[model samples]
Target: MANQTKADRAKIFMPFDAVKGFREALAEKERIIVPKTELSEERKEELDRRLRMIHTGDIITVVYFHDGEYVKLTGMV
Candidate 1:
């Protein structure tokens, strides 16, 4: 044991996962699939107006959908 390298000792203490891929499968199943909402004409116009108001060097926040989720981020433009 004393002669074993650090890498060898680390490998000996590594946990054994018997249910490989189970966690990922379970998370996929548990995830809620939300249907994307369609913007109304009035809503679209409002959004367009707000977008045009933004200019360079402005700090803003945006909300958008990605990969089955709605994400919001704030940063400088």
Candidate 2:
């Protein structure tokens, strides 16, 4: 009705978060995390040698485990 104020009309359109905190819980569930890897002395040496060979401007791809799955990122070093 023309007599209704904006605040009164707005109540009809108000929304509620019925499933509050569920999305946050789902986000926590899907968030990627992995345990730190332990490298053997020989393996560490090999990786150190490879890292020392790269220049600052070189491009490289890093592959590692996240939540037990391998994730890759490509970028310039």
RMSD of each: 4.4, 7.9
Pick by TM-score: which candidate is best?
1
Give the per-residue Cα lDDT of candidate 1 at 73: 100
C-alpha RMSD between model 2 and the true structure? 7.9
TM-score of each: 0.59, 0.48
Write candidate 1's Cα lDDT for 1-32 as tens digits: 88999999999889886899987899889887
Model 2 C-alpha lDDT per residue in residues 16-52, reported as the tens digit of each score: 6579898789988887676768889999999899988
Evaluated with lDDT, which candidate comes out highest? 1
Clashing pairs in 2: none
Candidate models: Cα lDDT each: 0.90, 0.85
Query: How high a TM-score does candidate 2 get?
Result: 0.48
Off by over 4 Å in 1: 1-31
32, model 1: CA deviation in Å?
3.7
TM-score of 1: 0.59
